[model samples]
Target: NKIVLPVASSGIAALLLPGGRTAHSRFNIPIDLKATSTCHITPGTMLAELIEKAALIIWDEAPMTHMHAFEALDKSLRDILSLHDPKAKTLPFGGKTVLLGGDFRQILPVIPQGTRAEIVSASISHSYLWESCHKFTLQKNMRLSEDEKEFSNYVLRVGDGNPLPTEVNEFDEDEEDQLISIDRTLVEELSSDPHKQILEATYGRTDQWKGTK
Candidate 1:
C-alpha cells in the first residue's frame, strides 16, 4: 500500500483507532516557534518524515483542541513541504489531503473559568482555517433502532438546544425560560440515594468489574 493513512486525535481516543497508534498532543512534535511567523516542526524528526511521506492525515476530535494547535500544524506542514515546491506554501495543509472530523456538541477546548464566549473563541471555527473548510452533516440516526428513533431525535434536538417537537414535549411559554420539571417519582428515587444512583448508572450495567471480582 503506497498511501499512508495516519489517524490522530487530541487524546486517548487514538487508541480506539484501528491500529492504536500514538496520538500525542498536537504540540508534541518538535517545533521552532521563534524562527518563523508560525511554528515549524524541527526538520529531521520522525514526525516530519512521516508527514512528508503520508498521503492522508486524519485528525479526530478536532473540536476538543485549540485553534492554535491546528494553525501550528498547518504552518509546520507548509514550511516543511514548501522546500520541494514553493507553491505548496499557499495551500491549506500544505496542499496535502487532510480530513478533520468531530462533533461540536462534545467536549470543546477547555478554558479555565471561561464564559461561553471564551470557550467558543478557542475552537477550530475561530481559526483562520475554518474559512476554507467544507462542512457535511449526517441526517440518519444510525445508532438507534426503528423503535428508538423518536428518542434519538429528541436527544439530538436537546443537544442542539432546539425546541422539542410537540409530540415529544409540550411546555407553557412561561416555563420556556425556566428549567423543565422532572417527574416527581424520578426525583424521589434519585433523592433517596443520589450517590448510589450515580454509581449504578455509571458502572452497574457493564462487566467492567467482573474480571476483578
Candidate 2:
C-alpha cells in the first residue's frame, strides 16, 4: 500500500479520508513555506523527509484556500523533490500525485471586506498551477434521498445564480427592497415543535428518532 498524506482546507476532509484531516498550513514535508511580499515560495531550512515517504497527497475543500497558498506549496514541493530527483523539479507537484477535490458551488475563498475581483483572484482557479489541473466531475448528490433528487438539482441551479421557480416565492420584488417572504403556513408548522420536526426530518422517520432514544 502506498503511503498517502491526507490534508484539507477544512474539516470536510475528515469524512473523505481514513487518515483523518491535516490543516493545509500544517501539511508540510518537514519544511515551512514562509509567505512574503512576492508570490514566489521561499523554502525554510529543513530536510523534506516526508516527500520521500508519502506516495500521494489528497487535499479536500481546496477552493476555500487562497491561490497564493497553492502556488507557494507547488514551488516548495518542487524544490524539495528536486533534492531527491533532478527531473522531479519539472513535474507537477514534484512528480507526486495530488488529488484536490472541492465543489465550486460550495464555500469559496473568504476575502473579508474584499471586492468581487479580490474574491475571484483568491480562488484556486486563479493559481499559477491551475492550468495543469485535470478536471473531474462528481454528478451524484450522495447526501440527498431519491425523493429529494429533484430538490437537489434545483438547489444546485439556484447556487449557480439561476432563478428559482415562481411557486417557491423566495423573494418579493414588489415589497420594500425585495424582502424575503416566508409562507405563513410553513412558518407556523416550523415554529411549533421545531426540534421534534427537525429530528423526524433528519432521520426521515419518527420511528428512527425514537429508536435512537
Candidate 3:
C-alpha cells in the first residue's frame, strides 16, 4: 500500500503532525554525518520496505536539519530504489515525491561552536539538491488573530532583519553590534511577589486550581 510519511527536524514539530516522527529516528540518520554518509537502513529491512512503498514524504522544520542529513537520505534512497530500477540511482529521493516545509528566516541548522559561515554552510540551501527544488513563499499569517496582526508583522520584520521605525533613530544600520529595545507594553513586570505572580499566571489562582487532582 502506498503511504505518506511525515517527519520533522524537532520532536515538538513531529508531534504536531499526524503519524509523524523525527527525521533522525525514522531514517536512522547518524549523529555525526560526513560528505559521503548514507542512512543506516539495510535493504530488505522493514523500514527499507516501507520506504520503497512510500508515495510521498512531508518533512517539516526542514531548515533546522543539517545539509549532510538530507544528502545522507538522498544517497540512501537512491541506493534502495536502484534495486528496482537502475535509473533510480540518479533521481532525487529515489523519485519519491518529497514536500519540505520550513522558514529559513526562523532557524538554520545548528553546529556547536560553529561560526556564522559554518552555520550557513550547514543549511540545506547550500546542498546540491537545492538546485532542483522548487520554492514557494507563504505571504499571509493565517494563525494570528486579527488583533495580533501588528505584533505578527513586527516579529516578521525582526526576522527579516528590517529595522522598525522606532529603532531607526537608535540603531545604526552599519553597526555590527546593534540592539532593539522591546516595547514595555509587551513585557510583564514582576516587581513584587515574583514567585506568586508567576504561579498565578501559569496555573491560575491557588483557590481555583488547588487539589483538583
Candidate 4:
C-alpha cells in the first residue's frame, strides 16, 4: 500500500491494477509491465517522477505477480519515463529498487498465462537484481500455529530446493474450466442465440484476453 499508493501521490503515471480488490470497485488491475517497458520511447509522466525520485518501489507481494508483469511494466516505463526509440514499444523502471517483501517460500504470483508460478522468470530470480538476491525468513511464527508451521515446514523439507511450493490454488480445477466456460446466459440476452456461442468462442483466446482467462 505504501509503495504503490505513495507513488500515486507523486503524480506519476499510476495504474491501480485489476483484481485483488472488489471486482466492482477499483482493484481491477489493468496489467503490470515493469520488465520490458523501457525508457526509450517517451518521457515519464508526472506521477512517474515520484517513483523516479523515490528510493524504492516496495512491492509487498511480488511473488503473486505474473510472468509478463515486468514486461508490462517495461511498457509503462516507456510510457512514463524514457523510451527505447521514438517508435519502440517497451519500458523499464530504470534501476528502481523493487523491495519485494513476502516470503519466496510462501505463496507465488498471479499468473494468468497458466505457467507454473515458479516459471515466471526462471532465468532471473528475485536476488539476481544486482549482485546476489537476499533471503530473510521470519525468526518467529507470526501468522501460523506451531502445528501448522510444522506441517508447512515438513512440506518445504519434502521438496527441498526443487521449487517453491504453492499455497491455496485460489480456484479449483473445476472453476478454472468454467471462467473460460461459455457465458451462455449473457450471450443469449445480449445477442442472437446463434451468434452468442460464436462471440463466446472469440473471447476465449486473444492477446488482450490472455490476462482475463
Candidate 5:
C-alpha cells in the first residue's frame, strides 16, 4: 500500500486527519534550528525507510511552522533518498510530493518577541524551497451554511485587514494602519468580574454546573 503521511504544525490540527502526527514529532526536527539544519533522522533507520517509501505527505497548518523546519526535512529527505537514487540528492524533499494547506492571512510562524519582518522571514514562504511549491486557493467556504455566509465573509475581510465602510470614517484618510469595527451584536459587555462572567457565559451559572461533573 502507498504510504501517505499526514502531519500538522499543531497537535489540534494533527488530530483532524487520519493517523496524523505533528510534523516536528514525526520528523524529529530540532527545537533550536539554524539556516542550515537537518532533521534528526538517521539514514537506514525505520523512519528513513518509511520516508523512502512514502508516496505523499500532507502538511496542515503549514503556515504556522518555521521555514527552518521545512528546510531541515528537505535536507534529511535528500540525504536519505540519495542512498538509492543519486539524483534525489538535488531534488526538493528527495522529489517526494508534499501538499501544504494553510491560509497566510491567519496565524503565521510565531517568533517569540519577533518583529513583523522577523516573523515574515521565518515563514515557509520566504524559504528557498518555496520557489518549487505550487499554490492553490479555495474560493468558497463550503463548511459554512447559507445563513452563515455573510458572517464568514466578514471574518475573511477582518482577517485580510480590510476595514468595513462603517469604520472608514473613524480613521484618517492617510492612515497606514487598518482599523476594523466589530458589529455591536457580536460584542458582549462583561461586568466587574470579567473572567467569572466569561466562564459563566461559556459553561452556564455556577449553580447549574455545581456537582454535575
Candidate 6:
C-alpha cells in the first residue's frame, strides 16, 4: 500500500483521500487510539487487519518514519497477533512477510513534535523494526525516455548503485525560472498592431530594405 497521505491512506489520519474513503472503507486498518506515530508504519487495528488478511504487506515510501513511530507500529502488530480476540488482546505481526518501498531520497512524515526517522535506520545487526525479507525491485521505469532511461541505467550500475545525478537538487532548492520579463517596448509592440514597422520587419532589414541585403 502507498503509505503516503496523498493517494491511499489510513482513515484515522484522514490523509488526502480524494473521494473520502473512510479508514475502515478502503482496508480494515485502524489506529490504536493509544498509539501515535512520528513516522508511518503498520500497527494497531490497521496493521492487525493487514496481517490477518494479506499474504504480503508492502510498506512503500515509509522509511522516513521516526524511531518511536517504528516502535509504535512494532508493538501494534505484535499486540494484534498475540491476542486471541482482536478486542481482547494484541498479536505479533511476527512470522509475517513485509516489503518496504521508497527512494530514501523523497519526502518524509512530520509528527507534531518528533524527529525524522531514518531508513536503513537501525544500527542493530540484523535488526527488525518489524521488517521482513523476500525483497523485490522494479528495474524498469516507463516515465523516462530513451536517452534518460539509458543514462539512468548506466549511472545505477557504475555509481553507488543509486543512480540519481549529482545535479539533482532538493525540492526546496532554487530552480532556473522559466518566466521572462520582457521590457515595456516589447509589450507595447505586441498589444498594438498586426503590421507595425518592427513587427512587419522580415529580419534586421525590413521588406522595404530586403533587396539591399
TM-score of each: 0.74, 0.72, 0.87, 0.40, 0.88, 0.39
Residues 1-213, model 2: lDDT tens digits: 877777888666665678757545445422232343222334443325654567888888888877766766676677777886899789877888888988888878888899879888779898768888999998888999998876776667756756343443554556433333333433445557788778766666676545564
**On a 0 to 1 TM-score scale, where does candidate 3 land against the true structure?**
0.87
> Which residue segments of model 2 deviate by more than 4 Å?
28-47, 165-213
TM-score ranking of the models: 5, 3, 1, 2, 4, 6
Better of 2 and 3 by TM-score: 3
Which model is ahead, 2 or 3, in terms of lDDT?
Answer: 3
List per-prediction Cα lDDT, in the order shown: 0.69, 0.68, 0.89, 0.42, 0.90, 0.43
Collision count for each candidate, in order: 0, 0, 0, 47, 0, 15
> How high is the lDDT of residue 156 in model 1?
72
The segments of candidate 4 whose C-alpha lies over 4 angstroms from its true place after superposition are 1-44, 71-93, 110-132, 145-152, 155-213
By lDDT: ranked, best first: 5, 3, 1, 2, 6, 4
Worst 10 residues of 1 by lDDT: 27-36
Listed per candidate, the RMSD to the true structure in angstroms reads 5.2, 5.3, 2.7, 15.5, 2.6, 13.8
**Cα deviation of 73 in candidate 3 (Å)?**
0.2
Model 6 CA deviation exceeding 4 Å by range = 1-51, 85-92, 108-127, 130-134, 150-213
lDDT of 6 at 52: 56
10 residues in a row with least lDDT, candidate 5? 162-171
At residue 59, candidate 4 shows an lDDT of 45
lDDT of 3 by residue, 40-74 (tens): 99999999999999999999999999999999999
Which stretches in model 3 have alpha-carbon errors above 4 Å? Answer: 165-177, 198-207, 211-213
Clashes of 3: 0
* Residue-pair clash count for candidate 1: 0
lDDT of model 2 at residue 26?
47
